[model samples]
Target: MEETWNEVLRDLSVPEDIATKWWSQIMVQYTESARIYHTMDNYLRKKFEIYDIMVKDNISERSAFVLAMFFQHYEHDTNVYGDSIDKNVEHVKNFFKDAGINHEGLISTVVGLLGAACESGSSKEGIDAYFQDLELAALGASPDEYVEYITDIEKEYSNMPAHFYRSLRLKVLQTLLLIPKIYSTDLFYEKYETQARENIEKEINEVLK
Candidate 1:
């Protein structure tokens, strides 16, 4: 994953020294002891896999899209909802500023995508839609994988009382199920819609029960 991340930085013409430094800092956050579900190996790496598939499919704005993915979860706070979005956006701005990468348009697009990540609706179009679907690809994983995902997330929030955690978790799942389509892109929708819905419903009924 580090090699692939460095390759992405190289493609963007970031200095190797700067890329190495940045990666070290990012790893510190991702590898924190409290990170069970959001670890680099689990959540972020899965998002990268989705990004790789999108790359093969010839998505546009590749630079901003990829950079956004790298920073999307750069700062996650399990105790808070939606706070990481703004922190990550600021982090991206400072990173680009420090790297002497003056492409404001690229930075703006990345920041916008980061903010868009918090949106509950998939009604967003184009790159935003793809990004939203990519962030949620786990929702459609195979049954066993989905169960593992749930368990890992539960572990991450273990600091909270089990009853409170389940209440919050149930509300989130119920909200996602209410969404018209969990995945917006035609590619994702066609491929994962049924399975994602089944996964969510099964979780709500069996696991949350």
Candidate 2:
């Protein structure tokens, strides 16, 4: 069988760098290492809630809202939220009431970020403007354009193992995808450059055949 995106994601496991970044940005501010497991537990539970609802309702939205949620949360410490984290947590906890299956941790983080972003008020409008620009950039291109672009890159880099090349490429692509919404300023360039180097050293180096 062909690989689904979720399968690709699961095979890679969570990146240690991502975990460390997350801990540093959000968790460490409020809790200790002992709480990380519990926090992960909460994230997974929120993810499952979205998954079950999505599966039950079978809404076939092509937009991949859950994945979008995950990206927003992972990259931004904030999501759509109001008042205290406690108050916002409940709203996020229930957003998946009828949505279908998705990657658990990914969805939860995104949901949380969505809450935080909304809480900030500026995020929604800003992201909306950014995506408008993104849509214009896409023009009337076919969806396969992306698949073909990645495939071409893979072919050109065939000397290396596909997994290694793709992993690094994926990180770069994710960064580009979120640059406007997540970075918004050049101040994060150093951080992203460091992350790129780290990805090359860790993921690409090991996975290369």
Candidate 3:
């Protein structure tokens, strides 16, 4: 049994399910590898605390994970982790699809996650000040104007991590563009309204974008 487990760990790139099991079984509490694994678990826990809030809903969780994988790998002009993008993205996408969600809403979901994550780390005073300006600006803009504003911001932040932040910004833009269409159009609104909080989603999407 120990030999079989060792062989599996040697192929560390085995499926996540297999990896999880092997780690759980072979890396017992007092072992050296187990200590390293638990340390990693703690790090992931801390990093994903904001992620948990962002993905409070199961659908959002799945989608955010998928989008993260996609951007982390396929985002253009990324300054970090460029060459390995394709392989990483493929690995992430496979993880998501393998985990069960197979679709496009993940982008929207991830934008919300990033927003929540960002907001969690900000001071109340800072967030209040930022939102005051944001609210005033939002009230005055049309959908196209909003998109233009986001694009401008996107351009200003040229050094953004394309996968994580930049891609998230784009999705937020897409959601903002999509909201008016979602609400004003009876057909589109009716279709998605039952499942998603259209107005809230729109507002949150806009704020993040």
Best by lDDT: 1
- Scored by TM-score, the top model is 1
**Which lDDT tens digits does candidate 1 get at residues 69-184?**
88888888877758778788889998897777887788888998899887865454588888888888899999999999999999998989988998988898899999888888
Worst 10 residues of 2 by lDDT: 132-141
Query: Clash pairs of candidate 1?
Result: none
| Candidate 3 residue pairs in backbone clash | 71-163
Superposed Cα deviation of residue 143, candidate 1 (Å)? 0.5
What TM-score does model 3 achieve against the real structure?
0.25
Model 3 lDDT per residue over 1-209, tens place: 23433343344334666546534532342133312212223223332342343222323244344234223312222344344344445544554455454445653444333333213223323322222222223223455544554454445355665556656655654554564332222332344343334333454555566
Residues forming the 10-long window of minimal summed lDDT in candidate 3: 127-136
Candidate 1 all-Cα RMSD: 1.7
Between candidates 1 and 3, name the one with more favorable lDDT: 1
Q: All models: lDDT?
A: 0.84, 0.37, 0.38
Q: Compute the lDDT of residue 95 as modeled in candidate 3.
A: 44
Instruction: Write one digit per residue (lDDT tens) for candidate 2, span 1-209.
Output: 01222432334363544434433443332233322222323332344343343321342322233333333333212221133345435433443332232457645544544444433223333433222222222111233543343344355455667667667665755544444433222222323334433333443344454
